[model samples]
Each structure stands twice: as structure tokens, then as C-alpha cells.
Target: MKKGWKLAFLGLLAINVVVVLVLLIGLLSPIKEEPLPKASPEKEAVEFHVQSNKEDLNRVIKAFIEKEKAKSFVDYNVYLRDQVELYGDIAVFSERIDYKLTFEPEALKNGNVVLRQKGIKVGKINLPVSYVLKTARDAYHFPDWVKIMPSDELIYISLDKMKLESDLRVRADRIDLKKDDIRFTFQLPIEQ
Candidate 1:
């Protein structure tokens, strides 16, 4: 009986030793992790040509002015006729005076348009063009892209400076009022 008891105790001790060794090996092993993905390269910009007539361009210009009017303190209207016409009222000595400014539109190669002041009519009062432009610049809320240059007698419309959604950009290809041919190019950036 003593011999049998000694053998059973030795077997249980050997089993416990094997179990502890396995547990220690598992605890000492290093963990493995997955690698990260690489960044994608930037894609090229895509260009699309848009062609419209004077009527469509007029509607678009009217809509743009109407949209901007909501954010402006003074009301104004811009339309494409034989030339670019801007109609607005300016306050002089606490009195509102109606004014009509006609500009000859000249499209540049760098996607910008310069409106050279051809003529101006101010409510039966003969005011200097510079003074009226200065007054409009000071009083009316114009968009950042619409630069009113009083000294130069021209309004610079910087299309590149105008921001659009989805990283879109626009360029004026051609704007011939006499021919009624207006064209624009829209640049869209491709997603990576």
C-alpha cells in the first residue's frame, strides 16, 4: 500500500509540472499585429466646357445678383445686354439717387473679366464717375471677387478667386456680347 501511494503522488506532481510549463510558454510569446495601409496619390483635374447664349447668361447673372442681395444691405441688379449693365441706388446726403453704369466686358486669358466703365447716368445729377464708384464701394456690399477700382474706372471680376463646392473652378473662355456667344470652362478635381 505504501509503494502504490508513492507512485500516485509522483504521477500527480509530473502532471502539474507539465501544465505550469505550458502556461509559462504561452504567457512569454509575442503578439502579432496587422500592417497599416499606404496613402493614395492625388488625381488630376478634369475640365468641362459650357456654352450659353445672352438670354441664359442674363438669367444666370440675375440669379447670382438676387442670391447676393439677401446678404447685402443695398439692392442692385446686374444684367447682360449689349454690354454689362449695373443698376443700383446710392444714398447721397441722406437721399437715395438712382444710377445706371454701363461697362464693356473684356475677358482675360487668366479666367478673369474686366468691366471697363463706358457710361454712367445718375438721376439728373452730374456726378464724377470716381465719386460715384467710391460711394458704391463704401456703401454697397459687394462680393470679394468683385473688385471695384474707382481710379481705374473698371470692375475686376476674378473668377479664380471665387470659391465653389467640391473643389470646382471656373474659367471664362469667351464672352462676346455682340455675337451673343458666351463660354465657360469648369474644372473638377478627381477624387483619390
Candidate 2:
């Protein structure tokens, strides 16, 4: 209302406009997105195999499972699969393992098997989280052993000079509606 007050208010408004205009210009300026480094085709295909196993490791896994079962009735039907030598000094092995309840008869038939793979780097193998299970009848659960359960597996015998162990896994190609049927690159040792 007063001349002095009006001038002061107008000056404040001018300052606000300048500030808002500067901010608008800054916001409208081009913003660059960081570019992601491109991966080479070969490097992109980098993969590792399961740990190679010799007679020693083979006997150990089998005997260990057997021993555990006899001592405590913790039944684990393990079938090794996907034995590979993806890289030098690296060995990966995988298997389909079913761990039943201490005394559940359906123990073997109540759980699911995932086709797990690993990328072996030095003495350790990095297991990936991709295993296949028979389709779930309804929920995200599988009936462990419906139709033919995966039994029997493969073992990659490593060279005598290499000190390695065998890991086993079941590889799946697709997931079923019930998550029951699974397709794999290889066949089960059971072959049925």
C-alpha cells in the first residue's frame, strides 16, 4: 500500500522471478546418462563347468551320503549331473538332490530338483540359482517325484593330475504349467 513497502515487495518479486528462471534453465539443460560398457561376444559367452571328479571324490560323495543315511535316517537321494570343464583350472559339477524329512517315505517324492549350474573359478565353483522342477500342481510347489523322478546322474572323471571334486545337477530347458515336466540338454543317467 505505501510507496516504500510496494517497492520492497516488487524488488522481492523480481528476485524470485530471477531465481525461478535460473532454475528452469538449469532443469531444461541436457542431462547425460552414463553409458554402460559394452561386452564382447566371446566374453559375453563366458561360462564355467562343474568340478571334475576322480575316483577319490566320487567315492567320497557316495560314501558320505551312504554313511549319513545309515547313521541317521536322513535320506538324500542325490543324482549328479551337468559335469563340465568350462575353463582352465576351473571345474564344476552339479546334481539333483532330494532331501526327505527324517522319516518321511514321500521324502524323496515331496521335494523338487532344480537344475543348478556352476561357474568354477579357482578352487571354488560359483553355483547359479537355476534349477528346474516338475510343474507345480497349483502353488509354486512341485510334487517332488511325479511320473519319473530324476535318479542316476553323470560323473566327469578329471585327469589324474587334477585335484577336483564332482558336483552334480539336473539341467532344465523349460518350466511346465504345473511345473512338472522339464526338458534338459542332456539325459538322466537313469535313462527312463
Supply the TM-score for candidate 2: 0.21
Give the CA lDDT, 0 to 100, for residue 94 in model 1. 87
| Runs in model 1 lying further than 4 Å from the true structure | 1-43
- TM-score of every model? 0.73, 0.21
How displaced is residue 7 in candidate 1, in Å?
Answer: 99
Best by lDDT: 1
Candidate 2 per-residue lDDT over residues 58-120, each given as its tens digit: 455566546544643223333322231212111112533332111111111112222222322
Question: Candidate 2, which ten residues in sequence have the lowest lDDT sum?
Answer: 101-110
Q: Which candidate is the best by TM-score?
A: 1
Give the whole-model CA lDDT for all candidates, comma-separated: 0.78, 0.30
lDDT of 2 at 88: 16
| RMSD to native, candidate 1 | 29.7
Model 1 lowest lDDT segment of ten: 33-42
